[model samples]
Structure formats: C-alpha cells, structure tokens
Target: MEFSLPDDNNNLSLTRFESMLKTNNVLFFDSNEFENIIYHYLENGKISLAKKAIKLGLEQHPTSTNLRLFKTEILIIENKLEDADKLLENLHDLEPMNEEIYIQKANVLSKRDDHESAVQTLLIALDLAEVDEGIADLYALIGMEYLFLDQFENAQHYFKKCLEIDNEDYSALYNVIYCYDFLNDNQEAIVFLNDYLNGNPYCEVAWHQLGCQYVIVEDFDKALVAFDFAIISDDTFVGAYLEKGKVLEKKKRYNEAIDNYKITLALDDPTSFALLRIGKCHEKLGNDDLAVQNYYKTVHEDPLLDKGWIAITKFYNKKKNFQKALFYINKAINIDGDNVVYWKLYAQINHRLNFIEEAERGYKKALDLGNYELSTWLARADILIALGEYEASILNLIQTAEFYPETAEIEFRLAGLHFTLHESSKGHYHLKNALLLNTDYQYILEELFPNILKKPSVQQQILNAGKTEN
Candidate 1:
C-alpha cells in the first residue's frame, strides 16, 4: 500500500547511466537524490553546486520529504537558516497528517531556537504517531528532546501518552518521573506513582524513588512504609533496603538501619553501599572491630567502592592510627585508580602522617582532575598551612572564595592568612567583610577575631551590624 525509493548513491545523470534506472524513466528520481547530493556537496566542499542542485530538485518534488529535507540541509549550509525553516514548515503543511513530516518540521524549529513551537508540533504528532512504531519512537524521541530542553510539562504529557500505548516503555516512565522531580511536584507524583505501583509493584526502582521523595519531604514514617512495601514486593531488591537503611540512619535509628542492611547483605548480590552502611552503623554504635569487619567486607565485595576504603580509613584516622589509615587509603587508590576524591583523602591522610612529597603528589592529582571544589581546596589549604606554604594556602582559599562568594567562613580564612602574614590591614578588611555577612559566625567571632581585637569595644561594633542583618 506504500512505496518509497532505494537510496541510490550516484547523481541523477549518473543514476540514469546505471542499470537500475536504465529503462525506468518513470521512476521518481528526486526521492532518492537528497541524501546523495547533500552528502556529496558536504564531502566535496561544493556548497554552491549542492545548493543549486537541491533547489531545482525539490521544486520538482516539493512534497517529497526526501527532497525537501535535502534542500533544507543545503540552505542550512548556506547560512540561510530561516529559508531552511520555511521549507520544513511548507513540508509540514503539505503533509500535515504525516508523522515524518511533523518530526522533520520539529527538527527545523528546534534548530531555529523555537523549542516551544517544536514541542507543540510534536505533541500534535504524538496522537497521530501512536499507531505506528516509527511514530512511537518519534514521540519518545521528542519527549526526551523536550526533557533536555527542561520543558517539564510538555515532557510529562508526551511521555505519559507514550506509556498509554506502550505500558512497558522504560523511557516514558523514567522521563515522567524526572519531569515530576524537576517540576518539584513530588506530592502530585505520589498520587499517580501509587497507580504505577499498583500493577507494576515489582518495580523496585520506582518504589525506591517514591521512598526517597517521602524522605526528602521529611515524612520518615511514609518513607519507611514505602520501603516496607518495596521489600515485600521483591525481597531481593538491594537498592530498596540500602536506601531504607539511609532513611533509618537519618532518623537516628542506627540499630534498625543495621538490620535493614543485614537483610540486604543476605540477598544474592551484597551491594557495597549496603556493606558500607553496616560499617557506619557499627562505628556509630562504638563497635570499632565490627565496623572494620564490615568495611573490609565491602572492599572485598567491590574493590572499586571508594566509600568502603574511606570508611575504614576514617575509622583509623579518628583513632589516630595514621599507619592503618595510610594503608587503607593506598588500597583505595589502587582500586579507584583515577578517582580524585580518593586521591584527595589519601593526600589529607598523608599530610597528617607527615609524608610531604606523597601528600603533594596526591593533592596535585586531585587538583589536576578538576576536582578542586571549595571543600577540597579548603582541606588542601589546611595541609598547606601546616607545611608553612603560607602563600599557597592563601591562593587556594582565594580560588575557594570564587565558589563561596559572600560567605563569612571563606572571608574568615582569608583574614587568618593575612593576619598570619602580618598584613593587618588586609586581615581587617576580610574580617570586616566576614562580619558584614554574618556577624555571629562562630569561628570568626569566637576564635579568629578575639586574638586580633585591639580592645573589648570590637564586639559591640560587630553586634550593631547583626541588628539589621537578619
């Protein structure tokens, strides 16, 4: 009932010389020529020739998408973007019910920076495209496109329509939930999520997301309720118990979190995340030996788990066993070979143990990987300040100030560095900036400022600013 042409490689005159078109003068030549001419022009850098060929060609087959699409590309290459867009618009009008026409038109609109119109056009095509697999893929494609554009409402509507026909469509469900989260409509998400879970109760991922939503909203009891239903629906769902353990930990129910983690470990694939939580619970309960055991279990189960090594290293670090901390951190580096967070932790521990060159190398590796967030830089500055790399520490703090601008904490550190260098004017400037932001900021007010106060009158000077601040 439908017919289209094969993609012939050569030009029309060349194809006429070929065997297939030898005696088929009636064959619709324009249909197969668009891709060839466009590619030929692009590959050969014959832009003007390509434009001329595509222009005269499409006039003969204006309704042929294959030809119109070719002319559109040629117009784009020629920097006549509006003309290219008008061609797609004309094609859509000529083939208003054609799903491919809608898709092509949407693509042109997207290139023209008209995302809202593109989404509306695709929304209309969604109903038309639902019956055909080609159309369904197109709808899914545009749904995801709108999601990338952060058009949450359109993304949700299109994805929901996609699922109306294909219930098991994973992209639709994933995008719809993403849209809900993006739009901060989690409360609204709950009503329909309950519907998704009713028939598809076995979807552990969906249940976990629902539980997290409840946790984010501070509804711990509901989070526990959701997790309980998740495990009942699928006992082997590792993420459900692991995330439930996190929620329980947030509620300070450390013992109960441990139990949930234990059940998760009983499953076939004991997750490193679960094992790490078990270690943390034991550590919190003051069972260092048990904590160490679970930490090792996590590392052995998945050596690539940086959290596992960090847990063990942190336990030893807190106990002041620097040697053991160093050992475990080294093991972590071997596992997550290029991971900067591991390297940063390793650097901090090395600095604690007075291994200067090793610490420098570790810090350098972390910084080189573009992992120098404010916290990482601040910690690095602490190590530098210890080594009397005074200028380096100050510079690191300055970089950190970029990320934490107008924050009193960073200003206080800047003041500390300037004071240490005996530049009181610069130090006072930063200290004053710190007070302007938060006059009562603990470290700045209590520790740093007290040592620099010329007289007891400075406390009143700062308190007066806090009067109008909050």
Candidate 2:
C-alpha cells in the first residue's frame, strides 16, 4: 500500500537532498520529488531526516497537502495528537475528499482509545477510497478497530470484505480465521477456508489453517490431507510438516510421525519441537537409545524448552530410575520454576523416592502456582497426612472440598482427617455425608481410617446405609 520511487530516481534524489543539506544551500524540488524523499526517509526510519525534508518541502511548496499530511503523521507518531488533529482539520478543509487525511485522523483517534470514532472516520475513508488497494486497506483498518472492541463478527465481516477485493490478502484471511476461532465456529471456518482454497488453491496459509480447524474438530484424517496439500503447495513449509507429524502421532503411527518430523529437520534448522516429538515417537516405538539421544539433543538445542527436560525426566521415571528423573526434573524446574507441570512432576518423583517433606513442598508450590487439579490436591493432602501434619492435611482437604463439593472422595478424606484429629463429631458428620453421596466409595474410609471403620457406631451406620440402599 506504500508507494516508492524507482531505485535510480530514489538514489539520485537522496544524493541531491544530502548535498543540499551538507552545503547549507536552499534546493528547490517539486512537490512530488519532496514527497518521495520524505517517504524514503520515513520508510528507512530516519525520522530526523524526514523532519528536515518536510520542513524544506513545505518551504518550497507551502500549499502541498501531501507534505502537510506527512507532517501530521509524524505529529501523531510523536504523540502530539492535538497538533496532529489541528493539522488534519486544516487539511480536511482544503481537501475534504482526501482519504489519507481521514485515515490519519483515525490513527490519532485509535491512539486515544476512541475505537468507535476511529471506525467511523475509517468508514468515511472507505467511502472516499477510489482504488481497490485503498478500499481493502480501509476494510482491514475497520476490522482491526472492531477487534479492539472484541466485536469478532463485525471484524470478520470487514476482513472478509477485504478478501472480496483481494483474494490474496493473507493478513485479512488470517484475521477472518482469528475471528471465527474467537467465536468458536470451527465448522464455519473450515467451510470458508474450503471456499477460499477453491479460488486460490496454492495458498499455503489457508491450507495450513484448514488443517488446524480439522484438528480442533477431531477430524484427523481430513487434517492429514489438508497438511499434505499444504506441503505440496509449499514443500518447504515447516508448519505443514509439524502438523502432519502431530496427526500421525495421534493415529499412533509413531514410525511415520518420526519420518515426517525428520523431514522438517532436513528442510530447515533443527527445531526443539520436532526433535522432542521425534524423541517421543522413538520412545513409543521402544527405541530407547534413539529416544535418549534425541531428548538430550532437544535440551542441548534449547535448554530453555521445559518440555524437552520434562520429557527426559518422564522417560527416566517410566524406567523406575528415580534418581535420574529427579535430576532432569530439577533442571526443568530451574529453567522454568513457575511451570505447574514441572512442580507437580517434581512432587511425584520426590514422593516416589520417599522424600516426603520435599514432595510436600513441591506439591504446595504447585498448588500455589495454580495447579488446582483434584489429583494435585489429594496428593498434597496425602503427603501432609504421611508427615503426621493432621491439621494441615485437614485444612488442605477443606480447601479442596470447596473446589469439588459434594464429592465422596473429598468427604471420605475429610472424615478420616477429622477422626485422626479426634474431632469425632465432625468426623461423623462428614462420614454420613460421604455415605449418602456414594456408599460405593466407603473403601476410602476403610483405607484411610480402618480403626474408625472398626468402631461399633461407625460400622452400624455404614450397615444402616447399605440396608437403606437395598
């Protein structure tokens, strides 16, 4: 959407402009020449040069609206919105039909967080746009404004309008798909991408997106075909290869997934993702040595990739090598201490090694980092009970019950903890609730509170519940 001069003319003008600046001589250039020089400076990010060019340009051609518009743009960039607005108002009076002026005005309004006013101004620019590219740009701008407002439907409509004007506008195509994704309309996205591909069959981006939509909808076969077509359209497309590898892995074609993943390595620099996936495929296929090699390479290529380290740790853990698992998980945690998955895995490995206090601390850190899953809560509470921290276990289970109310497991655990704490009244209350919810899980009571289960009153209550169920 930007215009640039030919290389020769651009170079000649730049040389002349520099010569004039160096000699402190007034050089006269027509409005078009000055505009090109200023554009060149702006495009190359020489803001001071651009400012000087604009100053000299207006001195020579004071009535040139284009040069003044450039000045207004710089004002907007410099956060002089008031001055930019004043300049735009004057420009609009001089040339009410100038679409660029309205566009610049919309830029200022968008910076001020006035998206509605920006969209209105862009609509005016759209109406004034006489060329296809300009109209498409206006549509994209309007779509972005609607996105800022979280109006996905409206954003989709405008971006689709942009595609109608230029079917090859990949930016607009991506935005249209993003809106559909935000609205959770994968089927519509698939249908739209299919229609788009029917016209532009060679668009790798659309084919790649279609594959992802199929993945979301769990149509693995269609996803595979889409990714294949994407690769055919652009054989060196790394994303297509990666998606195809994922689909193959889901289908349990581990060897085939490795083959496809290795293709990505040959086509470009080795990626940690591809290496990790290949390692997993090898592990699934019982290629332990190859799996270990790739896993080590994965971390070597990018030590910051926590998944690679976790993968290594899990592999060791699966083999009952607790020491090695603990070592790798420690490395992963060191790299990304805030990852809940790493903390949870750290807790599990420590627990396996009978390092109860460390395990408890790991679980507590996991919980603090927002690992609120039922398994994590139960593991932490169980660890606390093992450490004989009955009060802490009771409080942990109490909080877990808040997230998972009316659950027999939590209720049973709470009854066991209260009984262990000698809060017999509270224990009986929770025991009754657990039995009411699910008498089938009373085994939890037997497992955690066998002594309580032996009590005559508790046994009779459970017997009464069984008789009531019958």
What lDDT, from 0 to 1, does candidate 2 have? 0.93
Q: Candidate 2 residues 114-229, lDDT tens each?
A: 99999999999988888665788889999999999999999999999999988989999999999999999999999999999999999999999999999999999999999999
Cα RMSD of predicted structure 2: 3.1
Question: Model 2 clash pairs?
Answer: none
Judge candidate 2 at residue 425 and give its lDDT.
Answer: 92
TM-score of each: 0.59, 0.88
**TM-score quality measure for candidate 2:** 0.88
- For candidate 1, write residues 1-470 as lDDT tens digits: 02223445464543542333246444345545554655566678877766655665665666567667666666665667788778777876777776666666676677777777877777677677656556656667678678768888977887887777777786788778888988999887887678888878877666777887898788999999898888887788877888889999998899999998888778757888888888899989998889899999999998887778888888998999999998988888877779887888888888888888678778878987888676677667666766778788788888787877897777777777787788877877887788887755646434543554543344555566577575
Alpha-carbon shift of residue 35 in model 1 (angstroms) = 21
Give the candidate number with the greatest lDDT.
Answer: 2
Candidate 1: count of backbone clashes, pairs at least 3 residues apart or interchain: 0
